[model samples]
Target: MWTIYLGLTGLAAANPQVVGLGNYTGALEDPRFLTSLWLTVLYVGGSAIIGQAGLGFTLAGILRTRTGPVRRLVEGVVLLSWIPPSTVVGFLWFALLDRDEGTLNALLHTPGFAWLLDHPLLSIIIFDVWRGTAFSMMLYAAALENVPPAHLETARLADAGVLQQPRDVVFPASAATS
Candidate 1:
């Protein structure tokens, strides 16, 4: 391990080519790179910022409210997704989303669906959601635990409905921190 590290360090020190802001300027000027960067921003915004946050919050809410067999099973599956290494998750999604006979297309009964080629941004967004949502779920679960049960009890006394209680009690409690 040290040999590989020293070798890479030696290679880097040997070729002390400093381009200053040239590469940054060039990348900014390139249409393809700019477009790719913009698309990446969109992908992160759509998936990590929105999709994962939403799903994680929703799943956390479900785990908090619902009970019994199906909830246990779904919680198990979601927690399983969280435990796997991200590389493993990536490879799994890669194999599942393969263009030719991917799991998704196969399930949809569509053949030769070029998912990555035709919808590269959406594919990346979907994968980001898959690999990142669990983190948000775990975060929310912990946050939800800190919420005061007295708030919920008060909401119940006020005849708040299922969703209404969370809206009135939980969200407001967590809003400042969030």
Candidate 2:
């Protein structure tokens, strides 16, 4: 309601007048706004599809075969990464990526390298992947669990390689859940 009123009546102005579609037209005419929109789409699509889903599924597949403390530790760490509030994570990332006195710079021995400024999109995509992978991992883990051991045993008996077993048996069996 507020946005509609502001757009139609130029309510933001002291001497308000009916501007009709003028505000929207002005925004659409701006190249920077269009570029930002494009970047936003790219960021969202890339982070969800390529980064989170890909890495999450891959991790799930790899971890599915393992048992004991290693699996628990990895899952715990990933969950910890996901469970924190975004603001806290953002602050931690900022501190880690800051050009001056940053952990990354100190470790890399490349001081004064502005990671966030130089690679904002990549940084955020990676951050989003780290933040969001837990959901996909948990989902895929559950789905992978439903894949019958008998099918995997049959694949093994047929001389299927390690990767082939998951690619052929596990993936198809879990496709519905995915």
Candidate 3:
């Protein structure tokens, strides 16, 4: 209610006045607003759909066949990225991407590359993917369990390639959950 009232009137400003729709119109007309909106859509869609879902599904599929310490180690590392608080994760990523003394810059031998400023959208999308992939991985891991081992074995015996097994057998079995 307060937000609507503020948006409808000029009461939010130092000098209050009844400027109904002016604020909304101004925001709509601003080029920066449009750019920010577009970037936001792109970032979220790319991260959630392309990056997180795809990578998580792939990881889950690969890990489904494996067992023992290798699987545990990979799952632990992925979950560690998702388990931390957002603030802690943000601070760590900030340190990693910082211009002068960042770990990334040091590793790449690019001393002063401003990653956040130069590639804000890409950075945020990648961060979101890293932060959110564990959920997708776990979800797909459970879903992949629904896929019958017999079906996978049948596909393998039929000479299905690595990608074909997932597309034909695993995907059909897991489509409901997906």
TM-score of each model, paired residue for residue: 0.69, 0.74, 0.77
Model 1: weakest 10-residue lDDT segment is 3-12
Which tens-of-lDDT digit does each residue in 1-178 have in candidate 2?
9878887887557888998998889889999989999999999888999878888888898898899999999999999988889999999999999999899999999999999999999899989999999999998888989998899999999999978987899889888556
Clashing pairs in 2: none
Global lDDT scores for all candidate models:
0.80, 0.90, 0.92
Worst 10 residues of 3 by lDDT: 9-18
What is the lDDT for 21 in model 1?
Answer: 57
> For candidate 3, what is the lDDT?
0.92
- 1 or 3, which is superior by lDDT? 3
Model 3 TM-score (2 dp): 0.77
Report the C-alpha lDDT of model 1 over 1-178, residue by residue, as the tens digit.
Answer: 7644543342356674554555567768999999999888898789977899988988887787677998788877877877888789878887787888699889988878888889878988887787677789888887887778788888899899988977788888887567
Model 1, 155: alpha-carbon shift in Å? 4.1
Candidate 3 C-alpha lDDT tens digits along 1-178: 9888788888557876778899999999999999999987898789999989999998998999899999999999999999989999999999999999899999999999999999988999999999989999999999999988999999999999998998899889888656
Candidate 1, which segments miss by more than 4 Å at Cα? 1-34, 153-168, 175-178
